[model samples]
Target: SQQGEEDPQALSIQEGENATMNCSYKTSINNLQWYRQNSGRGLVHLILIRSNEREKHSGRLRVTLDTSKKSSSLLITASRAADTASYFCAVLYMEYGNKLVFGAGTILRVKS
Candidate 1:
């Protein structure tokens, strides 16, 4: 399966600090999207940057893509305890949006 694999399976950070996570994938992709899970209801879309793009940011979240290396990085600054959740990066192939696949995910624990 040419999918993404998130690192630090779990992380602990203090509120008002920052959290960084890494994801590596196999095979080329059309785009990559990051999702956040809270209360296990489902995943909420965070960001989606294409292969031709380099970096993208939304509020406190920042994402970088390296197509050649088949990897990506996510940075969240000024993290809050409410931000505690699992983060997963999904590789978007030609049928990405149609049939999205998910990574193992990294659990973020922000302590207040």
Candidate 2:
């Protein structure tokens, strides 16, 4: 079984907007991390919030975790064309062999 799943496999928006993505998972985890990937670029670590933490913010990015619901959310404020690319969330845990199983991903396109 897959550890995580993300919706809206793709997203597009005008520059200077906000983009939101949701993730759902099927197991317990120590924490969840969000990562961004630009076209032909490697995955860049964004932010990670522990299971005990409800939310975390980094720059224009906001992340939320709901352990009980086994879900999480990421909200990017004032998005830009630079944000265009694919976004993904990974669940981390030793229970899963300490591997980062990523969701399919959400592709965001910001129109300039």
Candidate 3:
């Protein structure tokens, strides 16, 4: 079974607003990473937060990890219409493979 599960299966927001998504996992992970995928396009890696790290940020994106709760969150600041995409949270297990195990993902639609 997949280790990570994302919440708020779908979301809709206006441009300039912030979009937040959460992920919960069942086991201890080496790291948690977030990715974004535009409709019909490939997935783009966003930010990654290690189990030892509490938070991380890249550009307009922020990621937080709470190992105690086995959860993580992604925040997109000042979202734009172009931000409309699907976001996924992946769990990395060293004992497994180097590839990431992703969740079902959340669909976000940003309106202008």
Candidate 4:
């Protein structure tokens, strides 16, 4: 199985709008996570959904996982200009414990 990949390389929207990013993987995973990265900085974990779980939410962010399809999605509601950043989806490889693979990520820009 391969790592995850995000669709729509980039997105631009106005504040208060919603942003959705999709991630697809090729292998079985123990868990899936979403992260946010500011320009020239480290990433911050947004949410994590276990393989057995179908969905999870944190604040204004929502995440869903489909183990059968080996896919996941991240949705940000009422996005603010501060949400402008790159979002990535990571998967915990079941074959290799402690190994986490990250997707290329989707760049989102929210204009005020």
Candidate 5:
């Protein structure tokens, strides 16, 4: 079962702006990964934060995980039109044999 669910199913932003998307999960997770997918294209790995970590960053992307709240948020700074895509949060459950479950995703549209 998919453990994560992203909020604000859709978002629209202007270029150079910042976009934030959040995800909430039901059970515990060993790690949480965020991915981006262009229309009709495969998902691209964005960033991942381990259970022991509170936050992780890569380039203009930042991810924060809160095991106590069972939630996470992804922040994209200085967004560009190229950043337009669907963002998904995948949860890896250690107890489930490291099974990864993905949320429905949040559609992001960055306009120039």
Candidate 6:
């Protein structure tokens, strides 16, 4: 079974705005990671927050995790046309070793 599922299947926003995406999981996790993928390309690692960490930030990206609720959110600040991509949340199941289960992802379009 898929451990994580992202909300807002699709989103459209203008440049310079902020885009927020959410994910919910079905099981306990050791850690959760966010990834970004451009059109027709492989995914790039964005950020990872441990089950014990409430939040983390990298560059223009911010991620928050709530293990108690089995949920997480990703925020992209100052959105740009190049930021248009699909965002995914992957969960590292606590009982599944190092395997990461990925969500369906949220397609974000940033119009300039």
Cα lDDT tens digits, model 3, 27-101, are 778899999999999999888899899999899998999999999999999999999999999999766766579
Better of 1 and 5 by TM-score: 5
Residue-pair clashes, model 4: 0
Residues 4-110 of candidate 5: C-alpha lDDT, one tens digit per residue = 88988999999999999999997878899999999999999999899999999999999999999999999999999999999999999877887899999999999
Model 2, CA-based lDDT:
0.90
Against the true structure, candidate 5 reaches a TM-score of: 0.96
lDDT of each: 0.89, 0.90, 0.92, 0.92, 0.93, 0.94
Clashing pairs for predicted structure model 1, backbone only: none
How far residue 62's Cα lies from its native spot in candidate 1, in Å, is 0.3
lDDT of candidate 6 over 2-111, digit per residue (tens): 65889999999999999999999988888999999999999999999999999999999999998888999999999999999999999999888889999999999999
Candidate 1 shows a clash count of: 0
Which parts of model 5 are misplaced by more than 4 Å? none
Q: Candidate 3: where are CA atoms >4 Å away?
A: 94-99
RMSD of 6: 0.8
Q: Spell out the clash pairs found in candidate 6.
A: none
Q: How do the residues 17-107 of candidate 4 rate in per-residue lDDT, one tens digit apiece?
A: 9999999987778898999999999999999999999999899998999888888999999999999999999989888777999999999
Q: In candidate 6, residue 27 scores what lDDT? A: 82
- On TM-score, the candidate that comes out on top is 6
- What residue pairs are clashing in model 2? none
- Give TM per candidate: 0.92, 0.94, 0.94, 0.95, 0.96, 0.96
Off by over 4 Å in 1: 95-98
TM-score of 1: 0.92
The candidate with the higher lDDT, 3 or 5, is 5
Best by lDDT: 6
lDDT for residue 24 in candidate 2, whole number 0-100: 93
